[model samples]
Target: MENRVEFYRMSKTSNPKILNRITEQILKAGFSGNIKVYDLGLDDEASMSLIVEGTYENEDCCVAVGYGMNRQNLAIRKKWFRHAP
Candidate 1:
């Protein structure tokens, strides 16, 4: 995939659910990869996302947690990619 981060969100669900949903998507799609979770903690006020990524059927797919910031809807997109392996 290209060297850019696309926009995607998973239905505005609770934190861990985001990861769970993403995992299912990737797995069902026949993609194998790791989940890169960024947790700065709520105490730090650092907004981070739990990311699930992999290459599915030769296409790059990624899912991230989002509470809104980029104006995109809270849902998943097959176009999203993070250059993940």
Candidate 2:
């Protein structure tokens, strides 16, 4: 098959909820690749932009997380990359 990339998100939900949702979707899609997670601040617009660029530029897909943020709570963003072996 021709090479392809995909993106996914399961935010605003509990860990279990997100895990279950993502797992089901990933399994159904039969995806195999590397998953990367990045933690961006709540209002860190500049960093967020850089993160997006870093994740998407020259890559197949990327995911950005933006929500509540603080020293204690941190939002998680993930990106999945698929390449030929």
Candidate 3:
């Protein structure tokens, strides 16, 4: 996920809420549309909603790092992902 790494290098925003250790702020938001996980690099093109400030965090405040596509769209690709960080 080279693009995901690049986002961390270039982003400047911050979150006030203490999120989980594993977190990913949206440099670009995603929406309900036909797309792929890698399309997250497209700041203005992805099908997700506009996120002024977003922190994708999990339970216990651990920041979740990953990509998201619409629920209905996942079946189109049937891709399985694993995260180890």
Candidate 4:
């Protein structure tokens, strides 16, 4: 099996509604297993990332959800990749 990854970005990070909707969509798309949320600090600002690692279309997959400034998101992405299995 091949490893797969998907990325999503949000402009409004402070809204819980949007975050919930995104999470719903992700789950509906077929990623089901362990869901983990991380709070990260980057360059003096708070950032967040959600990771869903499971099976998508019957194949192993990972989906990363992030919000906030582009630079911050980039940093979060790098951090996730650096520590991800």
Badly placed stretches (over 4 Å) of model 3 are 1-7, 10-12, 18-41, 44-85
Task: Estimate candidate 1's alpha-carbon lDDT, on a 0 to 1 scale.
Answer: 0.41
lDDT winner between candidates 2 and 4: 4
RMSD to native for every prediction? 9.7, 10.3, 13.0, 8.6
Q: Please give, for residues 1-85, the per-residue lDDT of candidate 3 as tens digits.
A: 1223212321222232311111233323222122122222333222222211222222111122232332212112222233445
Q: Please write out the lDDT profile of model 2 over residues 1-85, one tens digit for every residue.
A: 3223222332233366444444343333333344433333334522221122122434555444433323222233565554455
TM-score of each: 0.30, 0.27, 0.16, 0.38
Identify the candidate with maximal lDDT: 4
Superposition-based RMSD of candidate 4 using all C-alpha atoms, in angstroms = 8.6
User: Candidate 3 or 4, higher lDDT?
Assistant: 4
Clashes, model 2:
0
Q: Distance (Å) between predicted and true CA of 10, model 1?
A: 9.4
In candidate 2, which residue ranges exceed 4 Å CA deviation?
Answer: 1-11, 37-85
Model 4 clashing residue pairs (backbone): none
Better of 1 and 4 by lDDT: 4
Order candidates by TM-score, high to low: 4, 1, 2, 3
Give the candidate number with the greatest TM-score.
Answer: 4
